[model samples]
Target: MFGNICTLYYTRRKLIFDFLKPGNQCRQLVPEATVDVQRRQRKMTSPDDESRSFFAQTELDSLKGKKAKLARTGTHSHVFKATMDSRGNAQVAVKLVDLRSRGEYIERFMPRELAIIPRLDHVNIVAAYAIHRTPEYVAIVEEYASGGDLLNYIRTRPERYLQEQEAKPIFRQLMDAIIYLERLHIVHRDIKCENIFLDSNLRVKLGDFGFARELRPGVDSNTHCGSRPYAAIELLSGRTYRGNGVDIWSAGVVLYVILTSYFPFGSSKDEVPAIIKRQRSQSIHFSQRLSGEVRSLILGMLHPDPKKRLYSRRILAHPWLAETPHRT
Candidate 1:
């Protein structure tokens, strides 16, 4: 709802580039010193492709000649894995969004996401090297996670869930990315396990920013974006909500799923209304397998009241994250 108004007033590029620019409405949200430090850190930590430029141009012919396999599909985009160089060694992920689709996402959300990905340069975030746009499609070249997304990783596991020790560092890294985005005032409205990627070492790298946006102080987002199960009750109930709270709630759901390998509310998407009902009633249940501290932290983040919900900073400081996992 708010996005349509934004599109009418500001060009898509302006909306994306002006995120932390001086004179922008939310520029003061992040300090100049913090931005400077991030710039230096990006130079030191960003991969070679990311350091080149945000809008590095890739020849369409190069992509056309490569053998690509469909990696995943989203509501508005298809991600493919392909080799960027000869010998099929330099792997990369290419996200293709069909521009001609009449989908609401194509007109409202895609442009902002396309613009935001390149600007992000965090270790725990997937790096976008180049973007190729055309009337038919927009192709985004990104870092490839050899170990795949967390959803597939968990689903394929024999036990269907990570041991507490195994889940801790991965969740910590995911929170690191969330904390970084929080500092930048960018909220990843879609923070589910499917969007959390892992490398060969199983290190966390949060991907997929299709439902993301920059927030201004005192302004509330009216869009009901993101996966229903991972969405906050406020969004599901069609209430105007703060972006950070929405993210924290989604992250809580992610933590719950990874630790239990099951959704906290309902079994399927058709049960979202029931999920909302349960959420509002606070009729939540935890797996007996979860530790007391982790359960308390999850409850804190999943608080029905947005005002009382634990934010990224508070979640990071929770004793559960710092505790050593004991074998059962």
Candidate 2:
């Protein structure tokens, strides 16, 4: 029985990849968005030219005071909300990474992120306006989401959780973004509520591609990246994992947290061992308030076996996402 299941799982995975491969019908599902993205691409210059023009023409307003610190500091970078003096004071998020910081991230992952972010042009993904690079620092100027990140947005809510109706649209938007990335063979290894942003209209804008990389079909990645709480079982267990499956697992965790305001696995990094054990057992306790379809969807995504996990196309087509939430 186990061997049969393994065979079926591998077959399903291959079918999913075939559906998502470039020039497939999956691209037709997002025709309008794809056209818009292409239009934007036409107006953009080369990354080097854009970067040089941005720095030469625009002056960034300083982020100095205590209140000026816009985002949580990472290992070697500081993020701040700033304005461009040349572009009529347009708001932007500036991520400044200090080159002097000693780490593999500074030398390797940071450059990968810089190179990838510019080529992407999805509406559901945050836009990178410019990238300023120097020996001392690397500054990434990106679109500013006025509504802030999903983590802070949920925490500040009266219920500390979103209703199924409210969460549905958000999840759909995230699915759309993920599907777009998957089509490009880009895997966003770091996907969590904190990395998901909301614009002024509360639309989802996926961001933070620091751990993102391209993973070709039939290839596997061994790097263990992303927040512990959102990491896939294969990643947490120190095994080679398909990048797409890793993303699906994290997206499941994000969905769970959006609806429950709690982690589906262990809460903190310290509980990694417990999380791994729980993942192996395929143990996930869901709230009764979530509909049967929602639970099933999450279960499909958070499956311990990466081979059996739902792919991007499957997640987007799930029945739970097709239902319309009746607005109050």
Candidate 3:
């Protein structure tokens, strides 16, 4: 009886092992498991999966092409740099003028800049290359100045004093640009150090013509315009005065700052009113260290009375300027 029982147990164990194996009975019990295993195996080896895996790689080539195209051009109204084209054949600086910040001024002024700047072929002015206008954006393309602006140059080289010798040439160049504008009856109301840019070879390019206005023959502009520190006394006083005189006064202020690295008048914001009052009340002063001729020239330019201030022509012909030989 014990032998019969051991044989019966062996038979039952074999039958259970057969039932668990992959066959008709196991398939009947776990149909979904077989399908799931096959699906996973197919996913591991499928060409569709490989294609999806490499999709970004394929898209990258097209994106690189787009990036290359973007690199060739840049915007200016907002700060940006120039890029090279796909073939690397062209380079341009793009300026994006925000319609929101500028408002109606952008609509009125930008078109004028585009129409005016390209026609102006002066050596001292930055050349306008192109203008692109879209419903969403306005861009002005210009010649890229790798050397940046004069303000940055001066700030970076603080210890380097612009000696009379070095300054004379730059002054001459600036005068040429200013005189050219005057001849055209275009008054660059704003003339500050930052508005001037330099090329790689240190050639000056007067920029930012936003404040420029065409002066009709025999017409006097009484508009109060220009940076405060450089503005003439008459302009700050809200008095209608000669445009040329105002410009010359700014030039004098610029020259003074360039020479001494210090502003001649005012400190805090409240002091400006008093400074203007003083300019009207008293004669302008120069440090004792300045030469008598230089002092005389500056005072002549800064004269509170428009009639007394030196005109651009007279300034160019002044003995101080004539005596100093320009290097470049």
TM-score versus the correct structure, for each prediction: 0.78, 0.77, 0.69
Using lDDT as the measure, the top candidate is 2
Give the lDDT ranking, best first.
2, 1, 3
- Between prediction 2 and prediction 3, the one with superior TM-score is 2
Query: lDDT scores for all predictions?
Result: 0.70, 0.71, 0.57
How much does candidate 2 score in TM-score? 0.77
RMSD for each of the candidates: 13.1, 15.0, 26.0
**What lDDT score goes with residue 83 in model 1?**
53
Model 3 segments beyond 4 Å from truth?
1-76, 85-92, 102-104, 107-112, 158-160, 267-272, 281-285, 323-328
Which digits, one per residue and each the tens of the lDDT, describe model 2 over residues 134-193?
445566767789898999999998999999888998988888888889898999999999
lDDT head-to-head 2 vs 3, winner: 2
Q: Which pairs clash (backbone N, Cα, C closer than 3 Å) in model 1?
A: none
Clashes of each: 0, 0, 12
Rank candidates by TM-score, best first: 1, 2, 3
Off by over 4 Å in 1: 1-60, 63-65, 86-88, 323-328
